[model samples]
Target: MEEIIDQNEHVGIVADDLTSAADGAGAFLTYGYQPLVRRQRQASVGAPVVAVDTGSRLMEEADAMRATGQAIASLAGCRHLYKTIDSTLRGHIRAEIAAAFKASGRPRLVIAPAFPTAGRTTVDGIQLLHGVPVAQTAYGHDPVHPARASLIADLIAPDLGRMATVPVSATDSDIGKHIAGASIIVVDAHSQILLNRRIAEITKHGPALWVGSPGMAEALAAVVGQSPDRQTFTPPNAPRHILVLVGSANHLSHAQYEALAATGASVADRAEGIAKTASVACIHAPRARTADPSKVLCALVDEADIALSRQWYDAIVATGGETMSALMERLSIHTFTLVKELEPGFPLGCARLSNGRPILLAMKAGGFGSVMTLCNATNAILQMGRKST
Candidate 1:
């Protein structure tokens, strides 16, 4: 058994991917917690909130479980542990959740995967995106780790032991009734207010593993209280040049790319040999579907690597979790100090390279954000550069 520390001031969040890690941590920013997103299972002592990216969403079930367990074990000192799952029910949810439950030594696991801000809500144990079942959404056709079921219970059945579903309308007493004698409780939340109430009730019940999206994280931050004093770190100088890498084949990402290009940003199908004529340059994967997602990811990474070798950019905007993870690995970037959110669920952080050079990094999920999101991010980067100068 791992030695558990009893300190409620610190929080540990384990996410299955890089973007989700940042997204999960970003919520704490409101409470004056300086969150750090680490790519590995290393300890970052003294950080108010630490989010570790297990990078196991696309891995084999056993591999995902092992990775999640190791990550949770490394965060033994944190009294509060949160597992961030995709709102649409992507990834190896069962394996990772079970690993977190076992590794954290928590008696029960409370799951509430709702992000009303992003139009994700849970009702009667079923997950809905923009009021439609997630199975009928674009996420269902994800190139990798597509959601097979919209019902949260059906998605993680048989492996997580006995489970119960608590509706959003459940009062404090009602919530207590559902949590009793249940190893896992899935709470339904359709709005932020209800989500916060559910989290408060569930947490009041006892110390159990909390699992959900960023909305849950925000609620956790509120329940945990604010830090004594806000810790401030100066961000790196804004980049005069920005590189936008689109590795997701999602239609929303494609629309964002097109919108950015329409703003006069240079666009290219490949990252290599693109001239630095514009302040912002975008390299995106072919719009056509590819049978092998791994190959497309590898090629995108290689192209981005080659482009970086040829020219230096002040900031990098990566749109997909896999793309961001691959790029960070190529650049040997394992740690990111989150500055703030460029947009909800879109985080801007300062990452240090192997050579100790700090660069600005902004990450967004492929399926997230509106068509103007990339354009707005690019403009934000430019505005930051002007302010710094």
Candidate 2:
């Protein structure tokens, strides 16, 4: 990857094995990411390893890795972890593994930087570290494979300066379990070469499957192959929501409200209109306000949380099946749909067309009163792994 996206000062390298020479890149500089293979070669045998197990699949460090590797690597200081509840014997197993990860003290959050399966190895790290929920990435199967994870991250990052950003858009093959009108991606966009290499790094699991918005996702499908065969699932990054969906009666919990504020989505009434515009001074639980006019609705939707995310959502929409469907259709992307029978909480469902493009839909069903607030967040950690092509 570093060679693929090399700049004079910056090079982006994603290697399958955990060695410095693994990718044909030269030795690590004082300030570059290195995989473990390189580290083992350079480090003195008696030197303390001082490994920082991120509780993940563990990519080789920029310094530790070369183009070669016995293992992959990961970044450091990511905030998030997992805690496993197992039987007594399993607990003992966990404790021993934990010892190698951290010192005597319990680590705060067990951080999992979103890997292929989130890896059992990461789970064991949590037992060694403090109590952190297994952080998971939301991206699903990508033909681009190993490099796609970081590629998606780079797209969503505030700065697009790490490497050359080439936007590869391709049409998906129209022969799989995808929505109608959706096109799969071909060309270098869905780097099968990279995916295959990364899979070798994780385990022998075949690959994951990501099915959602027909447009971009189809691109991935085209590369992974049109085969109906399945294995592990490729997660999808929760769409960076630009608008906030709020019900008149639905309220935002203190924590939920804070999360909304943190992401910077907007607040709207069930009627799908904005209550405040211009500058939002405070992010408190807004009084349950109903939508009165469509203009108000449009204005509110326009100003919702899209700005809060690492993206400016095309639009911040208020809630309603009609509006949502309309938006999904117009955008030609999948919109989340909530089943009418599903209970309140977080609901998940997808709408697919016949092989062309799959529409990602989010809908909430059942006695959903018009008094709740809706906001879009990271859903998990910084494991966002997709962007509309």
Top candidate (TM-score): 1
State the lDDT of candidate 1 residue by residue for 277-303, as single tens digits: 678988999887789888998998888
Task: Quote the positional error of residue 150 for candidate 1 in Å.
Answer: 2.7
lDDT, each prediction: 0.84, 0.24
lDDT of 2 at 143: 18
Best by lDDT: 1
